[model samples]
Target: MARLPRLSVTDLPHLVLWQGHNRHAVFADDDDRQAFLALLTDAAAREGVELHAYALLDVSLWLLVTPRRVGALPRLMQGVGRTYVRRFNQRHGRTGTLWEGRYRATVLAPQELLAALVFLDHQPVRAGLASAPEDWAWSSHRHYAGAASLRALHAPAAWWGLGDTPFAREAAYRQRVHDGLPPEHERRLHEAAVKGWPLGDAQFLAALEAQTGRRARPARPGRPRKGGSKSVPKLS
Candidate 1:
């Protein structure tokens, strides 16, 4: 079996997880992270995708992006990859593709939107780069908190309409994400990791079910490993 090329899909949001080639450290250090962001911001300006959340760790990074145009994701991703790799190779005396290959992406529903936001923001902590998410400098956390100006990463002000102003809304969102998550929300994190589906309100589940044509269950069978139970035969 061969890996299929990234099928060009219509305008759909995806949760992407792209690792460095050979599991090598793509962001070797601070300089590497800055270089990557610079390229990313530039490319993002040309694409319509909204980079809602992200975290720049020491090795790999995470992102929560929604493509605004169909068939443009690959080109936009390639643009950032090429720009960063070119600089990375010149600086480190290396060459070749920096990325592993076509990135892993899962089309998601808005129901899972908040979970994705928290995960992307907390990637640094989860990866052991920092004790807290806000400590990491190279991330959209500050942007969301209204501390920094983010022109490329488009997290609209209206999303948080409760605030007296757009800046206030950003601040509120930051506090919600930064303040240690509630127990139920913490549990939600565990569920998202295993289920890979949005866990939220009943209405959200209904919407997801409609789109996927499958009811959202608490948990499903996970990927199989060898030297375990007998393989379940497929029903034809």
Candidate 2:
């Protein structure tokens, strides 16, 4: 069977979430997380891309990026990915690929965007790293919340549709994240963000189509599951 192709910005205007191979925890500590973000900065310099805002999780990273040029996206990814993996291997004393597969992306609308950002920020809480998203300190939450960007992230206000005033956008961002997942929607709690994969709502997605003018292709048929395969993700 064929597999659903990994979502790409080329095909959709989205909020991207992706992670390392086998759900491995590549971002160990603060330094590690910051280091990875720095790679994103370098990638931006090389690729001519603008990364609006992003969040760093234990095993993955969520990014909001747009390429300025049409053909530069792949080269941009290759440059950053290769450099990041190289550093990750050296620091951890490990060898081999650090990523699981291509990053998974999903189209999202502005109204639902706040939710997506919150989902990314709250990863640590979900992953058992901290009690709340703000407590983690490694995410781009600060950048959005009006803190001076760490330079590597290249966080810009325009990314979030925040206009010229940085303070207003920051206040709005904080409020949105502080709001949490709507009242008692526990079933969909983890669905929005599953291991760096962000899924959006049908209504908002329709709006997103209008705003970005990008259409998502249908999901491809994936490979058959092996009988008694030991690898399985436990559904919480």
Best by lDDT: 1
lDDT string, candidate 2, 1-236, tens digits = 45544434442335666677898986877888778777777777777776656777878777766566654456666777888788888888999988876765554434454555666677677778778766778766776676656565544333447655767777877877788776444234344333323346665445544554543323334543777555433222
Clashes of each: 0, 6
lDDT for every model? 0.66, 0.62
- Which regions in candidate 1 have their CA more than 4 angstroms from the true location? 1-12, 156-158, 180-236
Task: Please give the distance, in angstroms, between residue 137's alpha carbon in candidate 2 and its true position after superposition.
Answer: 1.7
Model 1 scores worst on lDDT over the 10 consecutive residues at 1-10
TM-score, per-candidate, Cα-based: 0.71, 0.69
Candidate 2, residue 29: the lDDT equals: 78
- Candidate of highest TM-score: 1
For candidate 2, give the lDDT of residue 231. 49
